[model samples]
Target chain A: MAQKPLQFRLNGAEKAVFVEDGANLLDVLRRSVGDLTAKRGCAQGGCGACTVLIDGVPGLSCLTLAETVEGRSVATAGGLPGDGSHPLQEAFMAHFAAQCGFCTPGMLMAATALLESTPHPDRDQVVHALSGNICRCTGYEPIIAAVLEVAGEGGGGRS
Target chain B: MTIHRGRGFASINYPIGMNLGGDPSQALVHSSPDGKFAIALSSIDLGQGMKSVTRQIAAETLGVPVEDVYVDTADSDTGPHCMGSFASRGTHRVGNAVIVAAKEARAIMLEAAAEELEVNADDLETDGRGNIHLRGAPDRSITTGDACQAAQFRHGKTVAGRGIFLIPLSEVEPETGEMTPVSCYAHAALVADVMVDDETGEVTVEQVNSAYEVGRAINPRLVEQQLVGGAWMGLSHALYETTEPRYPDRSHGPVDFSQYTMPGPGDIARHDIAILERPAPDGPFGGKGPGEMCANPIMPAIANAVFNAVGVRVTALPITPEKVLRGLKANGGARPGPRR
Candidate 1:
């Protein structure tokens, strides 16, 4: 195992770390960077709990090799907002979008990308955007509603 | 060459907490120097909102604001004993224990306040904002912080309370097969609408409408989340979850998420939930835990729907395509007359 020097913009701040060969981005961020928000649900990428916004696009941190993210910008759930002031975070809290919160970081990152790009995505669009993420507790309705509410549609005002 | 649609319904009842040789949960409530409260318990939240709900119970019992109570669900070594947060017992079991502990701590606060005001303890009441006032005199009141200081310095007493909730074991008549294993039960009914592809034998759940009598909802939103999430888990179990490919043979099976299949966001159907509050007499704030019961009815509802659609009773756990095709071939592809 070889340690490689890696530099990236993490949560709006420049960070540098040394990673082992073949280590994924999640490992470097959690073990080296000390940000435990991006969870390691399934290292094989089946569960999207390790999703991160890489250059404003939702990318699976567990699937991404450390070397590939060199000099890239990464954003996690902790990086969303310090005070839970983001519209999405507020919507999630209001709508009860998170249950166990294990998958919240990835879900937030994925929803963040969708909102940044489309802003007002429909139900199907929201569903497709979050398809990669897996939330075992929320059942996807509240999460979708939170994203839709932040998008300004209120998700048909469903309870 | 034709697709069929069908509907089915199921109703089920599940016990809230089990009495396995005396199921018990404990809580410790103590007041802080700032008049705030801390409750230490061994029950893990597990994302079921235990911390929030238990904190509310403590605050309500102590006549304090919710923000003044801090719930610490530390490990068993440091906190009081809890039977763990399963079997939907976190709310019913832990909640009752918390109320008891909070009540004890509240008594001490009231006594201390009575001494300071030169009045009887019974004449003092809390405003739930950390203020203790006489029954008739609202202005003549002392903050809980003052009472706590008096209790520690003058009275030399620790303002702490301990509580435990337990159910006595029921003696069973083995000859008659009758016994009360649990004290209360939660009920639910669900209707599932589904579509079945005749050629491909693929099934799709279109909608799920359910009504749950959840004793009471401590937090309505958290209950809704549990119902929705549990329904999806039921869907996964009914359609796509299996660890063993062959019976008693683990030669070939899914070892990881990629190999294993569960419902993703795309598979979610329209869900309509009706929450009914039927209070239990012994429940803390009349709440029967809905943690495990949410997944009970969906499996049978989906199974019955597949049968109604194709006139084939596939009794398997997951009504997979291969099994449906085999059943169809065995029945000579005798499709019911277009479900007219």
Candidate 2:
């Protein structure tokens, strides 16, 4: 294990941060990287609270070693269209699905990724793709509706 | 949404089978006997909006505005073993206890109201707005405010309620698979039409139509939302979620959320949700449990739909691509069932 300087873009801005060896991107992003939207839920990648994007693809920051993603493009839930005002976010609020708000980030990222691959993803596709993220509230209806709305608009995965 | 009212009371019922976690003395919280406020916060919001449901239950029962009904679940000290928010039992069971407690507290409030109006408690009834009025004279009603004032100042009185009631749920029989305990029960049917690639076992859930029998929908809007959420879980669990390692390990069950997939936004189908309320005999506000049952049958419904479309039945938790391919290979490519 070795310490090194890691350079990457957070929320679309270039930044340099020091990374300790064997540190998951989650720890570095929150503590060293100074971005707290990537919350520490289960921390072992079991919970999707810490999900961030690597190269526009949804990846669990908790499992990605900080050094491995150095000099690469990294994004978080903050980078998503709305600062909590995106269509997805709006849908979440309207449907009351983001009850606890803990799992929303992970859910958003995963949904963002799904829309990337398929614009008007149907219900089965949405359900299959988001199966990785866990929510304890509002079940999944509203989330499904939001994604479908975005997909229908051909907004599949971007701001 | 058709609310099938039952005599006495109603419950939102379902057999509990979700895999929930508990960190020792956490998750499950309760109140004490000495406390004046008899309350229970939903242990498992289960994304069902139960925090608000519990508050409403207590408020309605106590004949007070929801605000006056203090449903506190601050910390471990203020509560007893509160099962995590997973099942759709929040309003039914916790609300039942709260209702009983609130009813007791309301009785106390009514007693004072009776003394003030110079009428017997039997001659008084609480208006839905929490005002106690004599049966003959609706205009001569005492607000809960006045009653409380009389109890505290004029009568120098005190009253409180406390209790915890866990839904008596029974497990499905190992041999027959017949579920018992039957605390609260809800049945739902979901129809999912999916698009699967012959190359990959991956599936795209197209449209979904769900029907549930919630004993009661205290909040009709919330029930629909929670059902949609549950449908997502059921769909995801049937198609993707697994507790086994990508490799294999008995010591540690699947690592957590990372290794599994739950239904996400893209995964949602065109939804047609219908709430059928068969009010249980004991649910709060004539409402039975509809939360988890919405998720329970989704997998089977989806699986059945997939079978109907492509002609295969992948029975494991998630009807994954690999399994779909296997089933497809076993047959031809697609079997016919029903389309969503």
Candidate 3:
């Protein structure tokens, strides 16, 4: 595969990178862009660890070709916190929402896409949106709570 | 090692004699003096809350918060050599060790408090933040950090908490192929309702109604999170989880990440999680393990739900569309079920 020069909007900053024709966005983001926030749990799209945003929509970067991301606005977990701060990220830490912190970035980004589109998702909707992301810990309660916090639910008020 | 061989004690039925929930498990908790803690856990947080629990135990022991304490939940190297993180040992053994270490530190602080306030050692209390004072006189108090500093300056760091947790060893001998219940185990029951695609075998878990006896809830939110994650993991194992072999399964399973099925954010339905706070005698806070509990029952529960919904029983996991179709065909090749 031949290397190609690709340009895209990352987080909110426009960036350019060169990668082989068949390289995945995951590799490009991790190696080329130096964004380690997007993890590599399963190279396949099955894990949701590599979930990202392609034009504000949730997507799995591991299975997506780098070529597909050209001229598109890309978002990683790192990108979600435009001001280096997001309520979802705060709720995650306040609620002990992260364990290894490896899955934290990925999980936050995935949920960001969901909450951004639907601000007040019901419990069922919350589960459906998070179905693709696997959190071996926290089951789904606190994560749901964190998302619910954004919608003015009982998240930070922990006993 | 009592393997009762009567009617119910036979291979499948032999829970007959000895004990139902005797010991906690193989690796429990062992504590030392200061606040050094270790846990030999049958349970793991796997990014859940074990680490926090460990820290909580250490800090709470002497009336401190999490930031003032540090605990190592899992150890691949020389742990305080703790066990693997699988069950819910964070509150069990690890918490107990913190109790022990904190108690030790508390004794010293109590004696000091008694001398300073002219009260009984027991009459004194270490506030939730490690500051020692008389029961009612919050005015007469001393910080644990100060105490430690004083102690370190004089006697050199006393009452360090250390623990070794061994779960009930259910070691199945490779030679005999037998399961030996090393310690008492943790159990959970879940009731799940799901919607399935009759044509695609695609199933959506709508709700999970479950109750677990994990001894205690050191951090209720964290436990709930574990349950949610565990439930999803269970769903994956039952329906979609796959390890694309070093190569591929002889069963013609797909090798592509997109093709290899696993639970993702899109596949889950809403959940109703209920945590049962039944304190296990063997558990730390009476907390039994819930790490793998939710996962094991998910697939089984889904299969049962499918049976209740229609009239098809698919023994195999995941109950994919193809399996449902085949099962439907096998059952008189008809759309099997009593569709209301």
Candidate 4:
């Protein structure tokens, strides 16, 4: 296989790596970039476990071509504020939104996009936004509640 | 083309831990020089909060703060032996082993503290806040860290303990052919409300109300997580999930999540759960395993709900729209049964 050069701003840091042609962004980020936070689950763009921020929009990294992200900004779950202070992370912990946690990074990214755009989405909106992500363990109740809690909507005001 | 609503109910009792020769799990507990305890086990968590629950059991048994305990479920080579995590036995079996190991380590810890304080081991008690004191003498106390340090350096003793839990297998009676398969059981009941469209024969679960009598809720939040998630999985199994839609043919098998069907976040219904605790006699902290039983009742409840909604007794794993329509057509029309 032929290799290609790709450069992207990863989590606000410039990253340059050589990738095989047609390699998806998920493989490049995990295998080359050493960012294992983005999980590889059902790498067919259906599970949404590899969802990442591509230029401030939530996109499936598993389906994205690495060359397309060249010079573009890519953000993963690791980019979330550390120290356990991010509102979504705090809300997730308080609400027990993550189990097994394979889907947490993508769920957080999707919820992050929703909050950034709507800021106070209703229950139906939250459900619609998170429909693509599949969590085998959480039943989607706590995940939705965590996102809604951050939006000051639900979660029993626990957040 | 009208949509009809109906309700159905189901109840079930599930056994905790399998009775295969002796389902055994072992645990090892040892204290570091700083008095922090580490539990080594081969049981896997698999996102079921196994590590967290065992840590709590060890801390409680040792009379120490939960933060002072760490559960290391490393590989089988480094950790002790386990019969694997299945049959919902992680809590009941592994928890008991952890309690036993922690108790032994606690006894050793108290012995070291007694030696340092020039008192009997029976007269010393842990404060659960990193301190051990002589009975009736609050001023005469030593920090757990100091005691552990002394045990390692001055006393030439290792504050460690090993534990294993097993239930002897029951032999079948040749005359009656009866044998005890499990030690304890967890019970659950569920009521499911669903809406069925007469035209397309689509069924949508609207709400679910359930009650679970787990032996005891070791961690109430973790138990709730299991209930909610397990019920969702049940709902999926009843209506959506199928590895091979064309079963015997196996031609159009699903290769990825897109072709595979499961309930999405939008498909989740409203769930109301009530947890009942009737502690088991031989359970750890009077707690039984609630991992696999939470999803058992939803399948039957949904099937009965479909029957009530359209009078079609679709006995298949997934009551898909085609099956419902075929049943409705075969029955000559929509014959709504009595609503539960």
Candidate 5:
């Protein structure tokens, strides 16, 4: 294992780091770049806790090779405003969507991709979009309601 | 070839806390010169809103605003002794300790205000808006911050209190194998509606309705979160989750999330919850623990639902499709149980 240099736009800022060959994007982002928001839940892509936006599409960072993200835009939950002013963050707080918050970053990344692509996704669409993400807390109900609230759809009343 | 729909019901009376040895939780309440309160404890939150609910309890007991209170749960070495946060004892046990500590600290705070106002401490009352006032006189008052400052700087008194809650261990009768297990109990009833595909043996949970009698909800939203998430976990354990599908040969246990199966967001059922509050006398603000027991009733309810749908009684966990199919075959096809 030799280490190589990888450069990419992370959260709208150019980030350059040296990563070992076969290293995953999650490890690089967490260990090398010091961005610890993207959690390594399963590390096998089955649990989407390490989800990140690769060029506006949600991808599991644990499954992504570091070098493959070279020169590409990698968006993480850290990309959201730190002031807790992001609409998703506000909605999550208002709806009590997070508990322990280990899966929150990935859920936010996945929802970010969905809202960016389809601004007004329906309840089923939200469920399908978040199907890949797993939350052991909150039962995915409040999370769905939070996203729906941001999309101007009120809680939608139990579908 | 047909999908059979059936409903089943299950109820449970769950104990609140473990009575192993002696279950105890300790809390320390102290105030700064600025009147901001901090509660120190060793109980871990574990994503169940332990800190938030305890803060609410402390604020209520101290007669102060919630925003002025903060909870610090340092490690065991730094904080007070706790029986840990398992057995759903965080709310019932730890909250009682916080209440005692906050009451002691509030007494000292009122005493200091009484000294400054030249009135009897018994005649002073907290307005819960950060002010200590005379019981009958509305205009005669002093801010809690000023009271704290007077207590610390002028009176040279520390506005702090220590509290510990303990349920003495119940001695077991060796001959009878009997013992008092817990202090209080929470009750729940759940009805699961499921669809079983007779041909494929796949079970889909269509809807779930549950009612919980949690001795008073300290925070209703947190209780709701626990109920919803616990039911999902129950459903997962009922139909999908298993580490050893091929038991007795422990060769291929799941090493990752891919092998370990759980219900995804798409597999979630429509759940409706009704919370019934019956305050426990020994509970803090009449609140009991609602963490672990919320998931208990759903597992048996789902198992019963599968039995009602296909007349297959699955005694083992996960109730896998293969087991359902085998049970159906043994019973000579899908024998739907009589509807209740």
Candidate 6:
């Protein structure tokens, strides 16, 4: 397979990479681009650990072919503002939304897309939006609370 | 068009650490020349916040800020030996070892500071801001980094400490098969409320309330996460997960998460947890770990609830719809079978 120069905007920088056809954007970002934030959990779309923002939309990077991302903007957990400045990141830490942090990147990315789309989403909407991401730790309560907190909803409306 | 409601209860307990007598975790604490420190241990974090908890313990003992301490859990060959992370002993076992090591290192740091300040080692105290000063005198102090330089160059002493936590062997009485297997045990009780649809043979757990005695929570948030995650795991085990569904036939076994079912966000129940603090006398900082105890009681509780709802007993793991329907058909959902 011939490799092609796949160029895309990552975080805030424009980057170009040589990727073979059928290579996944996850591998290109992690191996070729040296960004290890996006975890390689399950590799299959089932885990959703490789979720990333493609044009501000959450997509499973593992299932995405590298060539398809050419000229598209991609965002990841590392792209979030440093020092826990992002509302989601601060909310995550404040609410103890992360444990092990293996799934944090994907969860954060998924939540980022959710918050962008539905700023005042209800508990069910948050759950539905985060259905694709799986976290073995923190059970999803704190994660849900963090998202809701960032939404200024005083946490999820769970009784 | 009928939904049967039921409730069930279960109580369980789990040992804190490995039962083996030689289950030991070792830690090595060393100070950097810049007054920062690192703890070398063989215990892997496994995303359970082992690194953070152990770091807090080390910093507390060393009288340093938490930010000044770093934990390196990589390379078991280079780091001290740990009995792996599965035994739920990472926090209790490794934390004790870190306390011992940090205490030793703190003594060395104080001695070095005393040398530079020309003060008695016993009279010096650490202010936790990388500074050492005499009691009742905040104005006169020396930086820990400066003391480290003096210790190495002037006193020719190294600032390091080593520690290990080991449990004594409990001899088993052959007749009764009884032994003190672990130093302490964490206890939990769970109540599961469910609704069963007789027509579809489906079970939906509406809510779960649990009480856990974790001895002590080094980090309350981390404990809650473990409890919540563990309950989810137990729910999956009781209602969804199975290695060999068609038992004795390996052809239809699930090979992946997609094939093997687990409850997603939509299926999760409302979980309410009540933490009971009963300090363990022998535990580190009066803390008995809660790693594995959270998942112990969920299965039996859910199974009991299913039986109460439909008056059918499921004796096997994962009370799947097929099993529920089979149980219902066998007894016609008239009377509950003998409880397991």
Q: Rank the candidates by DockQ, best first.
A: 4, 1, 5, 6, 3, 2
Candidate achieving higher lDDT, 3 or 5: 5
CA deviation > 4 Å runs, candidate 2: A1-38, A42-48, A51-91, A105-141, A144-159, B1-46, B75-87, B136-139, B163-180, B245-259, B332-340
* Superposed Cα RMSD, model 3: 8.2
List model 6 lDDT by residue over B54-170, tens digit each: 998988888888899999999898998988888688888898999889988889988999888888989988887778898888777888788777777888887889999888678
**What is candidate 4's lDDT per residue for A15-117, written digit by digit as tens?**
9999999999999999999999889998888898999989879999999999999999998999987777888999899999988999999999888888877
Q: Can you write out model 1's per-residue Cα lDDT over A79-128, one digit (the tens) per residue?
A: 86789987888889999988889989899889888888886788889999
Of 5 and 6, the candidate ranking higher by DockQ: 5
Q: What's the alpha carbon RMSD for model 2?
A: 8.8
Candidate 4's C-alpha runs over 4 A off are: A153-159
**lDDT (0-100) at residue B197 of candidate 1?**
85
Candidate 4 clash pair list: none
lDDT of 1 at A89: 84
Weakest lDDT window of 10 consecutive positions for candidate 2 chain A: A132-141
By lDDT, who's the top model here? Answer: 5
Model 5 misplaced regions, further than 4 Å = A153-159
TM-score of chain A of 2: 0.90
TM-score, chain A, per candidate?
0.93, 0.90, 0.90, 0.93, 0.95, 0.93
Answer with 3 or 5, whichever has the higher TM-score: 5
How many collisions per candidate?
Answer: 0, 58, 67, 0, 0, 1
Displacement of residue B249 (Cα, Å) in model 6 is 2.3
Candidates 1 and 6: which is better by TM-score? 1
Report i-RMS for every model. 0.9, 3.9, 3.4, 0.9, 1.1, 1.6
Sort by lDDT, best first.
5, 4, 1, 6, 2, 3
Arrange candidates by TM-score, descending: 5, 4, 1, 6, 3, 2
Q: Write the per-residue lDDT of candidate 2 for residues B114-218, one digit (tens) a residue.
A: 998988988888766657799989987888777877787778776555546554445668999885454556666555666666656667777776667777788
Model 2 Cα shift for residue B229 (angstroms): 0.9
Pull out the clashing pairs in model 1. Answer: none
